[model samples]
Target: MHIEIFITTNYYIGCFFIYFFMLYYCYYFYNMNRKSKRILVYGIVLLCVFGMVVVYKKNSTLPLVILNAVRFYFAGNPTEDVGYAPVSSKDFTVSVLASGLTAPTRIALTPDGEYMIVTQLTGEVFVFSRKNGVWNNKSRLAGKIDTSVLGFPPEELGLVGAVFSSDYADTGNIFFLYTYKNSEGEIENRVSVVSLKERFGTLVFSADPEVIFTANVPGNFSHQITDGIGVSIEGKSHLLFLIGEGFDAKRAQDLTLEGGKVMVIQADGSNPLGVRPYPSFPKLQAVGIRNAYTLAQNQYDARKRVLIGDTGPDIHDRIIYAPFF
Candidate 1:
């Protein structure tokens, strides 16, 4: 028989089993010679019938339709707010600006605040703008980071962060941090720049990127790549990025490896601004971070400190403070 027909027939078979079991139980209870045997058989039959009915309803579509009907009648519409209480705030009103974004990790706004670039962890960058008081997708920016080449799963190792240049209005340079497997098939994190242009009245970002910095992740273990890409609030020429411990907690303490360190590099791929005591890695600024998932500069404070949210090792997640160099 056809698969659909067989499945449908199974549902009826389950109902029949329950019906027969009940009838037999009732007949045995009234006319059985042994009272104890009757009770035991009834219990066993009830359990077997219940199991069959549960399995059948779980696999059949009819139960879903019945359940939804019951919910609608008793619980009202799922989208309707039956007992919602509105809370008012004197300072501000909150609302959703956009929806249907896939795994959005970072958002970067243009220098003029005319447009916003939202980066998804799957390597797609979407541009949104407020048109007629509603934010909508203007276009999708193109780039050349091959998400398939990453050694880890897409969610674990794809585009993590993005930041627009301070001269973005003039140069349209945008920076991104992403993960990809090197020629040796080892996972590596990279920071690159791409120039955005306009053609035919639409924004056209570069499909080819100019890679400025790259660091090799030591092992096949996934889960902690560099995150939180941002431009220095003090000077746009300086770029700040985080390097995770790459699943090795000890690497957070090691200064030699780039893992678990916050790095500063020139946007133009030149040597960093400050004088370096060690020539081995001049860009290395701060250490002892397990996995800095997010980074932000304090624009409100005059001191201009960089705030870091670092993931901990089974102990406690921490928010760290460091002065922006």
Candidate 2:
């Protein structure tokens, strides 16, 4: 019904404009003629009504009719090609290194594409390096990682998302967002920046990661969620962090604990250099989200928005438009 209305509206508007132009032309051809003027005006009005009827008929959909048409259309057709040429499945065998890992939630690729990082549901960030056109695991960023201050409940936790510095090919800086313990020994969601060390030209994971910004947000492990990490292209200090509510729906509105917010901050884990801080607490971008899973900037538009695939109770999966900074 909606499609029919839409198509009808567009078709009528188009036909009306065309009819009006023809009426004006007839007026030009027969100026001050009463019959010609009546014909012109009546003809155009009749065309409009007829157009609506025709468009309604053309756009209307009947389930049974459509099903029969589809069945007949494909009944004797042997050609697989309809519009696009088909490609044989055996023609390509592209394989990724971390396909066997369970619940590889997020992936990060270096600026040079030489290395890739995969975060897992088990709280481990697995590093994959491209060597001789093939990828291999280099290291796993896990173990000895504090969870209490980083904001996760005393349940099983693992790495969620990671990002290499836009200048990592030159600066070797990388950051990871996960659940960890705070200063008071409480689990929380937070982001941390760590400098990757190049030992003999190989990247190695570090345990003594630099605490850039440990969010003081309070929440249980199941309530805190940070899904994706990406450095802002505008400034090295500016970083985009995706905040969300975990599978547990009861804690979506907890703002003090960074439950559903996009926290943006510096590389050293501080607010913008000269900007006055918010009264609520640390620096943050737009808040109020369900579960933001992906953060990306449009290459052509330079607009930034988080791709939130929220877990809902029998609701449609939505892709929300989170405005750019």
**Candidate 2: regions farther than 4 A off:** 1-91, 94-103, 121-123, 137-144, 148-156, 181-185, 246-257, 273-282, 302-306, 312-314
Score each candidate by Cα lDDT: 0.67, 0.59
State candidate 2's TM-score: 0.58
Question: What is the per-residue lDDT of model 2 for residues 47-98, given as tens digits with 9 covering 90 to 100?
Answer: 7666656654763322333444567666765435654333765775544344
Look at candidate 1 and give me any clashing residue pairs. none
For model 1, how does the per-residue alpha-carbon lDDT over 13-92 read when each residue is reduced to its tens digit? 76777677678767776566697666758776776656555655544332443454566578654456644333766756
Off by over 4 Å in 1: 1-99, 137-144, 149-155, 200-202, 219-223, 229-236, 277-280
Error of 2 at 302 (Å): 4.3
